[model samples]
Target: MPKKTDRHRPEPTSHTEPDLAKAKAVSIACGRRRFLIGLGALASAPLWPALRSAEAKAPAAAHWPGYADAMVIDALGGPGEYAAEPYAALSDKALADVRASGLSAVNVTVSGVGSYAKNPDETIRNIAYWNAQIAAHPDRLMLVRTAEQLALAKASGRLGLIYGFQDATPIGEDLDQVERFDQFGVRVFQLTYNRRNLVGDGCLEPGNAGLSRFGYALVEKLNEQRLLIDLAHGGERTTREAIARSNGPVAISHTGCAALAALPRNKTDTELRELAAKGGVAGIYLMPFLRIKGQPTADDLIAHIEHAINVCGEDHVGIGSDGTLSPIDFNDEFRRKHAADVADRRARGISAPGEEPDVYTFLPDLNSADRLDTLAGLLARRGHSDARIAKILGGNFARLFATAWSPA
Candidate 1:
């Protein structure tokens, strides 16, 4: 398992040098106790075992001194976690947990499901909401606009909130809005959600229409602005064309390997490899698309990672999770609410095909306050070298961000 070191554990000076295993360890048993006394609910995080609960929890390795220390970046988080409406701001408890979660930076969608109709108002208001949140909790969270800022977030022990969009609907016919949004600190933008837009068809659209003429123009505008282009829920034609047409690297921020479980949302081997060859990265999510049947397990998550690495090369794959940091409560009440929500999504033509009655939103074993730490431990156990694990955790994403955010 990935072990914890003291918060004082020094970070590695070079990416290609020694791995995290070489970090110094602190052995004061009471130190753990004193720390937990201050943590309150975070001490009893969902999967904290009974036997280990007695021992004072060590400052998590995933917190900053281990693999998570090397510029950890989640390509994107799942939906329903980043809504701007109801004026969601990081609560004190949520802030505390995020501080302890060990992430350097993560992409949070501020736009509603990628529609032009929702673009200016919904997205602008969402940005305003995050503005308020950042202003309120300046110590715990900050907006990340560049790769240097991503590294700074890691060293500063704060979570870098990256604004992203799941769809390109916000720009509408006016491509100028792309540059305007970039000026607004929106860094990552996906081409589509689950349906067609003016740019092109989504993965679920039966027509499979490729990138439009305007779509090509938009890609150039996005490239010109140095904003990262993402092709997550885009159709096969759109995915291929966008990757081929972009002047620089483009990302598939959250996806699965169709070679493992043939879901519409998952990418074929060609898409994975091509994106990697072009210097882009693909992040495998911890969702139902990883399995063909039943709930996904950690084993399933590992398999997808391995497959993505095999196809996309180790440098081009990372964990997007596509899940919230919040633990999913699978009680009857939640299940009922989620079911109704899923049904409503389908009725509205937003639900993807793989989402079913029992297909869980997150993996059971990975459901916890320290899911990122747990993921690093799981990857370590599977024989991934710390260097490779570092890339999988966030190195690749950071490299892409550096390139995309390069000054024009």
Candidate 2:
């Protein structure tokens, strides 16, 4: 996620909600005007839609016997278009895709990352945009604050959207912002993105400096408030230290096993073991980081999942496909845009080693609305029991979320 410069921002439309009255008027009404303008521009690139081939077909959904009764959750994903256009109403296709996804809940990111995320006001506006979405589509969506709400969403057949941050820049130097954002219904907070921040070094930081004094305080505050602490992109020392220090279990929301593919973005076995030992969960992502040199296939994804299960046990492993629900339509225009997007990330210094122009972020063979179900069948064929598949799907993460959000 590169910084959102003015030139790259989209023009403000009527749905941009320039007026604070339209937004859930909060303590930060002072920056309401700037927030709306920034959000209008920020909405253009919610989460980068990495290119995928139009010719690539999704696997036909197989019959997973217990899939219907299972409560599925994408620990680190979006409603797809909810990230793309939160300010505007969701498109018919976007709505249809999410409803068809069979997703019980998704921990959708609602804050900026990288240098552009320095402003707390921008995060506030992102939260407002999501709130507006839930209000607009009450029948289809709900903001998940507690574990009970997650179950309710599944029981009601609605997609519960949980607010989370991929980076902690929005917290800034003020420790109070932790609880402040928590009151706004933010449930999960990641210490860093892919580089250094106030808390500590990210996975890309060569120094590998562990948590700072402020970072330690942030952990305590997060624990006291009962918010889920995510160590997905933290450096080695940071991840290990946070896992040791937190009062409750934390989550490495989306990543691959570094033993299979030694990428900085993927977690090491030591980290995974430590995370699981502390009652934490590790979510394997469907990103290019799963393989070192080529586009990751379904087997490559399964290998990482199997490795994680061996290292952390079935209860600790789950799916966290960083990609959106809708598969990318890699037409000529999309390819052009994809190239430019990669170039921009390279220029901004946020691009990782595996992020090549040709390597898409999702698994091609398994790309579809019913991807989780398809994965279940693949595991079932591997002799994974129905109970094991259920835990890997969402049961484990659901339990972890409930514990993290529970009172101290």
Clashing pairs in 2: none
Error of 1 at 394 (Å): 0.3
Residue lDDT tens for model 1, 269-326: 8888889889999988888777665566565667778877777788999988887766
Over 1-408, each residue of candidate 2 has an lDDT whose tens digit, in order, gives 211111221223243223445233322332322222233222222222322211222122354668888999898887654135346667677778888888899888887888744558888888998798789889989999999999999999999999999989998889899889999999999988888988988998899999998899999999999999999989999999999999999999999888877788988889999999999998899887877765665666777788888789889999888877776654566556667778998897778778877766666556677778877766665557788889999999999999999877
TM-score of 2: 0.84
Clashing pairs in 1: 116-169
Q: How high is the lDDT of residue 233 in model 2? A: 84
TM-scores of the models, in the given order? 0.83, 0.84
The alpha-carbon deviation from the true structure for residue 289 of candidate 1, after best TM-score superposition, in angstroms, is 1.1
Candidate 2 ranges with C-alpha deviation above 4 Å: 1-59, 81-86, 116-118
For every candidate in turn, the CA RMSD to the true structure comes to 8.5, 15.2
Model 2 Cα shift for residue 147 (angstroms): 1.0
What is the lDDT of every predicted structure here?
Answer: 0.74, 0.78
Q: What is the lDDT of residue 295 in candidate 1?
A: 60
